[model samples]
Target: SQITIPILSGDEVNAILILETNQEPRFSLSDWDFARRLAENAGIAISNAQLYAELTRADESKSEFMAFAAHELKNPLTPIKGYAEMMLKGATGELTDQQKQIMHVLRTNAERMQTIINDLRDIARMDARQFRIELSPIDIYNVVIETLRPFMQQLEEKGQTIVNNVPEGLPLIIGDATRLIQVMTNLVSNAYKYSPPGSTITITARPETSYRTPNGNLHKNVMYISVADNGIGMSEEDLQKIFRERYFRSSNRAAQDQPGTGLGMMITQHIIELHNGEIWVESKLGEGSNFQFVIPLAVEEGGDTPETSPDAATEPASD
Candidate 1:
């Protein structure tokens, strides 16, 4: 049956085309022309609707960035700045162990704020196509180590568990080390945030020799890295839209509430793509999630990648 719904949510109206071809052939030609015009009009309406959605999303992203900058970013920075001033002035007598620890937390979080800001600015440049990757031969093993180090102290303090399953003799890939590290950092951070206390988050990487690119081309010696967590996974609907801008926490996350800018994953995509790699996620509602990224093995200088290793049983130890 021909669709009865109006085109583009009634931003334009359309009707079915029926013809009495048994009548004048001239009349049929006129009817067909009108029908063609209606179809063309529908396409225009769809284009306009798509343009509207893009504009709206851009505006919403901008507004969301401002709100986060003012509330989440600025609010934390103020106290951190004030405390540093107090410590420098010696106005607040000798600091106790607890005070020193809290100060350290503040200083660390303030540095994190700077990192988030840098990511945001990088995203803007990326969207403008002005971003470039500094490709090099990278030791992904060391990259994983460096990326996971900053969170070690925090994980210990929170009593949270992390398991790093990346193998010791993994193939190195050619890509931008900084961006890949950023991608891993974002996924690990998100996993840590949504995961319950004492639950474990595992980071794993394996070479994918069987996978093909979207263009149906074969990629040799490609490695796929996954960061998986035993946390509250996303719903099917949420999984479908997880990379969308401005998505916040789920309805069930009261205790796990964190400052979520929602652009983290979006920016992560930009970074990975900039490195000429692909990233995706798999999850179930109650089961855990696995965020994965793929990069070619030849990108690294010293990676004489051998045949794929049969090491599915290895556990992550970087946690």
Candidate 2:
């Protein structure tokens, strides 16, 4: 005699267990019950394993498509940007006032597109563990000033005021100047996006005795910097999703209408981690938001701090 148990997962029989033995009585009631229970669990495990395998394959395909699409889009943006710049500069011919204004808008958006493409590539490289940063002594205040300079006209248009509270005597920290500038630019731009006209944005910095790294390790002697704005703050839900999802825009109607790729904070977080530092945020729905990050201070030497090595330097920005 034979006893068989059909393993059902969801609405489908995924497998079965069969007991075959030449015995007086083939199986007892208790034996049948135990076999059925074991078969059901086995069916669930098999179904889950198959589902996980499918998901992994899908994720890999998505990554490949993203990398390829970004590369193809980036190649043409450079030439498009160049032509737009030349037209704005009268390289093709002298343009009327109206033509110049149109060309300026075109050029500006082209640059923005290039930035988006670069961000996409950065994200893909980061996933592949190809992203890197060259650590060096950086003057945070100067980087902030320079990064904010380009937005002066926009600030004026919005009637926004910026307060730079970075002290003059702040110590240089070990970090990549360009990436740090990128971080500041993103935070400031985000502030500008959600804040109303005439709002105030502040940048502040201070020295820290010790800081915690992402890996739960503690290190001494770091610098803390923050960008704060009296903008439309995010809810706890939005705050949680910001760093986790790429191209995630806030559910706030105001923020949704604003222009952004949403990869900035994620890239900023990665850069901070590469420097063995931490990044965080604080906000309330009705009040405002503060984005903060910390980087290690340059090692003290007798005369001058040694320059950081260029090995594993940040990958070149996609064209």
Candidate 3:
């Protein structure tokens, strides 16, 4: 005699459970009840496994699409930006005021598109575990200053001012100088975008000798930096989700009005983590916001001094 039980997931049968015996009684009432119960549990587990597989496939597909799309979109932007720059520089001919303004708009939008494409590519690389940074001894103050240079004109137009409180003489930190600049630029840009005209954005930094990680690990000689602004701040709920969620945009009207992909903070967080650092934000609804990060200082082989001079290297802005 043989008995067969079907494993049902929702209304569909996913598999069969069978028992065969040559005895007079192939199965008992209790045996049948146990087999059915076991089959039911197995069905649920199989369904969950299938669902997880589907989700993984979908995530992989999305990342692939983002990478491909970003590459394709980036190709045509090169010529567009080049031509705009040539025209602005009078390569073709002397441009009129109206023509200059038009070219400026073209160049600005092209640069913006390039920034978005780079973000998408970075995100895709991060998903594939291919995103990397070149670390070296870097001055946090110099990085802050270089990052703020391009924003000066925009700040002036908006009647906003920036105060650089990141003093010199602090111990140099081990980091990717370019990536650190990117992180600083993102924070300052957000401050400029969300803050009211005439508001002040402050950049501050200091050395912390007793910084402790959440895991109770004490980090000696870490550089702490913060970008603070009296902008339209975020809610407690938003502060909770900002770094955790990718492409997360706040529900505030000011944030909604800003043109952004909501990927900057997530990318900033990833960059900090790559350097064995931590970043966080403090904010209230009507009050300002403070975005801060801390990275360990670079220690020389024989002593605690930095290997490189802070004034030795300077990163120039691109056109």
Candidate with more favorable, higher TM-score: 1 or 2:
2
Top-down TM-score ranking: 3, 2, 1
TM-score of each: 0.65, 0.79, 0.89
Best by TM-score: 3
lDDT by residue (tens digit), candidate 2, 1-319? 6779888778898877898779777678888888888998999998899899999888777767778888999888889889988997789999999998888898889878877887888887887777888877776666777778888888988999998887554677888898888888889989988899999999998877777744476767878889999999999999899998888889888789987798988998888888888888889886789998888888667744433323223422111
Predicted structure 2: lDDT = 0.82
For candidate 2, the per-residue lDDT at 71 reads: 95
lDDT of 3 at 302: 90
2 against 3, candidate with superior lDDT: 3
Return the candidate ranking by lDDT, descending: 3, 2, 1
Instruction: Give the lDDT of residue 217 in candidate 2.
Output: 66
Candidate 3 lDDT, 176-229, residue by residue in tens: 999999999999999999999999999999888768754456767888889999
Q: What is the lDDT of candidate 3?
A: 0.88
Candidate 1: tens digits of C-alpha lDDT, residues 117-172: 66666655555556678876566776788789889977886678777777766755
Ten-residue stretch with the least lDDT total in model 1: 1-10
After superposing candidate 2 on the true structure, give the runs of residues whose Cα lies further than 4 Å from its correct spot. 1-27, 126-130, 167-169, 211-219, 284-287, 301-319
User: Which numbered prediction scores highest in lDDT against the true structure?
Assistant: 3
Whole-model Cα lDDT per candidate? 0.70, 0.82, 0.88
